[model samples]
Target: MKAKIHVSAAILATLCVISFFSITLLVELFGTLDQVAWIKSIIVFPGLFILIPAMAITGATGASLAKHRKGRLIQEKQKRMKIIAANGLLILIPSALVLHYWASLGQFNLAFYTVQVLELTAGFINASLMIMNANKGRKLAHK
Candidate 1:
């Protein structure tokens, strides 16, 4: 049951990050400024509500499960998750908030784009780390 919760929450959190990345790219490429603002608002509200809790649950369950385990893979997963969490808290969340604020005010200036780029980059980094963790987890499960 703990393992199940860990996997489910991890999947949810990963999907949210991917969704944010994809939507941001699509909107920036084809949508208008107003659309960007709307998307930013959407990303900040329902998106964070879902993502943050899912991540917390994932980490909590992962740590609980790892408590009894002894292996390098488990250590690696924990390390990766720590990095992911830091990236989200230190870079992604603040970037999202700044982007949303700038966009809300119709401030699609250099600063807005700058933060958008930063958010996307951090999101990509987190996504890649999460993928690596998931793959390692699969190997752990198989053994």
Candidate 2:
């Protein structure tokens, strides 16, 4: 149980770090709005090095959590995650709007931004559920 907490926290922490850089890239994208040449979108290429590990660790954590717990608690955790994830989608709407409408942002290279988008998208959604589940686990642990 302690291990799970530590691991979850680590994963969430990593997610937060990823979110930070993704935002940095977004702001840079926005700043470059007027000058965002199409070919520069290729710059997103290198960032995937960070994105892939984040994804794999996140997936592995989920798999491990499920393997570690076998009962109604896991089911409850999963159910809560589903609900939070739905709300998490709402979190992205604003981002989508900013990315799509704001003239400066729209001018930026889509491919260059795609890496940031995917990182932020997955990080936000996964972190939301992971945190929620972690909190739920804490409350249950107290009982």
Candidate 3:
């Protein structure tokens, strides 16, 4: 049951980030400024509410499960989790907040685009890392 919870949480969190990345790209490419603002706000509000809790659950359950494990895969998963957490907290979250604020104010200037790019890049990296970690977890389980 615990393992199931961990896996589900991890996958949910990964999907959430991927969704954010994909939607942001679509909106940025074709949507109007109003659409961008709407997307930005949506990403921050309920999006964060969903993502942060899911990630927390994943991390907590993962740590509990991996506490007694020792191997290369375990080490890699741990390292990846740290990177994901740091990137989300340090880069992605702040970028999302800033972008939302600027976009809401109709400030679609160079800084907003620059930060949008940064957020997308960081989000992609984190999503990839989470997917890799999930693969490693499956391997660990089978072993």
Candidate 4:
């Protein structure tokens, strides 16, 4: 049951992270936030509503699974998870806030672009780390 929850949460979290990345990319490609302000606002709703809870579930289930595993492998996974959480808190969340704030105020200048880029970069990093963690968890589960 724990493994099922852990894997499911991790998978869902990965999908949410990827969705964030894709949306950021689409916004960038579309060029000019003014053109797609509505899209950004719509995306923000899901990001806030879905991604946050998914991340929480991922962390909780991951910790539960880690408690059962023993040795250096578990320790390493824990370390990576910590980094992932830190990245989300420090980089992704803040960037999202900055983007939203600037966008809401109709400020889509260099600052907004910079924040968007930061958000995208952090999102990709989080996604990559989550993928690695998921692979490690899969191995640990089958062992």
lDDT of each: 0.93, 0.51, 0.95, 0.77
Candidate 3: stretches off by over 4 Å = none
Candidate rank order under lDDT: 3, 1, 4, 2
Would you list the clashing residue pairs of candidate 2? none
Q: How does candidate 4 fare on TM-score?
A: 0.88
Q: Candidates 2 and 3: which is better by lDDT?
A: 3
All candidates: TM-score: 0.97, 0.42, 0.98, 0.88
Model 4 off-target regions past 4 Å?
Answer: 31-35
Model 1, 40: alpha-carbon shift in Å?
0.5
lDDT of 3 by residue, 1-143 (tens): 99999999998999999999999999999999999999999999999999999999999999999999999999999999999999999999999999999998999999999999999999999999999998999999999
Native RMSD of candidate 1 (Å): 0.8
Candidate 4 clashing pairs, residues 3+ apart or interchain: none
Task: At residue 102, give the lDDT of candidate 4.
Answer: 75
Residue 115 of model 4, lDDT score = 78
Q: What is the lDDT of residue 69 in candidate 3?
A: 91
RMSD of 4: 1.8
lDDT of 2 by residue, 1-143 (tens): 74565456446544644454455556565755543322123223333344345444544565565775667777877686565445334543334434444433454556536744664665566556666766766665565
Task: Provide the lDDT at 66 for model 2.
Answer: 70
Local distance difference test, candidate 1: 0.93
lDDT of 4 by residue, 1-143 (tens): 86677677778878978887896787679757674465566557766677778778878877876776688768877888888889888988777777776787888788788778787888888898888887777788778
Pairwise lDDT winner, candidates 3 and 4: 3
Clashes of 1: 0
